[model samples]
Target: MSILLWQIEQHLENHLACRFGHLNYCSLRLLQEKDMVQGLLKLQESEKTCSGCAIGKSHRSSFDKEIAWRASQPLELIHSDTCGPMQSITLGGNRYFLTFIDDHTRMCWVFFLQHKSQAFNIFKRFKNMVELQSGYQIKKLRSDRGGEYTSLEFSKFCEEMGLERQLTIAYSPQQNGVAERKNHTVMEMARTMMHEKKIPLKFWA
Candidate 1:
């Protein structure tokens, strides 16, 4: 194990400029022929090494079943979700962001909010915008069972508007996979763009 660690350290030092901790899990795991954690710990003498690999590599299971896309047109089905209370608050004191995505075109709408309750108003705006732009009524809407989406007001609005509302089974994010995945993508992109532009971390609102 020590020998393997030495070999990895030497190899990484030659090709990489950053500390071992900065390299991603995949890169570090290459040091081990098998048993990722065992391989990394053999080189534990260096405090400079990133321990992220040891922790991250431990998770090997595949994701839950993906929700099947069943709609054909833009407004035929829409997926809605909200993310955050970002680790850092935005300049305007906004902490949450809502996103609505069309299952067909993959187009999305982003709205920043101070609370999850704002999801209701965002949905209203998105429904109005899409209906006007495409001249097609929303046929179905899908989201997690967050109170924001399942509230009496929300239910009444959907019923009155004649739109079908679908809620994923409790604790089953994969059942709302489209919106769940898009939420991660948007936040990841936001994080990358914010860092690249040197935007203040708080402006994620």
Candidate 2:
């Protein structure tokens, strides 16, 4: 065990995915199959769990499943989320990111921002671009009660456009599961890939 640990530490990026990358079992296997990793083919079969991964990934108890409602057509519903104040600024000087997902198609769009205040403007641009390209008017927008979404101007704009608003209950992220899960998945993949490539953190943006 000691010798194996030493070997992995000596070539961490090339040999392992758990401790340094926080990658889950599925990601490790997928990367391995793609020949994107090397030198630790035996490690994945270990019965012991990776403690570092457990500690880093620990989360609160799961919530009940999402509501039974589903969107039937594109532009019928949209899920939006913001994630940010990252530990490191990206090479592009971004500190945060926003995501918009079409509930029906599950198509996602991402926009980078240097400040949270930029969310509203970026959202407008996203709306215009997507509506133009998809040839569909957005019928509803769903998001948490963030200041960007709650602002008077934002509310008025939505009203004027006849877009229904669906705000999640306070402190209840599970109600906005679509956007929340998308953000989590995107960031997790980015972290794992960056670690695998030994890429600099600043490029994460």
Candidate 3:
């Protein structure tokens, strides 16, 4: 019985010394209260830095306040993004999809594609359809620095059409928040609907 108690004490002491010694006493106490660690009584102050603790506690700076996009007219500005090479192929054999969002109306258009190369053609079709319907041509398109939007053919088409291309910086999705948020909403809604209707995974085209 004494040996068992001694083993427990050693384990607890080692845990404090090696694992969670970097944390202050209050945090250690809280962790003990939550039963995250067994037999933690207190933390001893030490000069040594805990590499794991330093990494775990480090955080990136918060993003700057968002500047909302305000368009005066439909098709004046459009935000676009492409999502997935999904894990499962859809019934239509499409593995990827693209989305376009109008900044003014918040209207969205979705197109399914089997390859990324299809994005430029899809955008052309979308532009014609929306312009014909609304009698307003697209002025500016804002999207991430995707190869589909940066291709020579895509750039030439935009130039000929007098459409301004606004590409977000690499690795910056927040700069294209409208389309990103719309895509997220669409995905979540689709997931919920599929769950409620018990729709098969293949039908999620």
Please name the candidate that would achieve the greatest TM-score relative to the true structure. Answer: 2
Give per-residue CA lDDT, model 3, range 1-205, as digits (tens): 9999777865664456444424445656677678877666644342334344344334323334468759999999999999888777897789888999998987889999999999999999999899999999899999998888899999999999999989999999888878877666556545544554566767778
Candidate 1 runs further than 4 Å off: 1-69
Candidate 2: global Cα-lDDT? Answer: 0.78
Better of 1 and 3 by lDDT: 3
Rank candidates, lDDT, best first. Answer: 2, 3, 1
Q: What is the lDDT of candidate 3?
A: 0.76
Worst 10 residues of 1 by lDDT: 44-53
lDDT of each: 0.71, 0.78, 0.76
lDDT of 3 at 153: 97
* Best of the two (1, 2) by TM-score: 2
Q: Encode model 2's per-residue lDDT on 1-205: one tens digit a residue.
A: 9999867754554345544345555656665777765653634352334444344345534445687788999989999999988999988889899999999998899889998888878878888998999899899999999998999889998999999999999999999888998787667656655655667879986
Model 1 global lDDT (CA atoms, 0 to 1): 0.71
Off by over 4 Å in 2: 1-64
Candidate 1 clashes between residue pairs 3 or more apart in a chain or in different chains:
21-50, 90-202
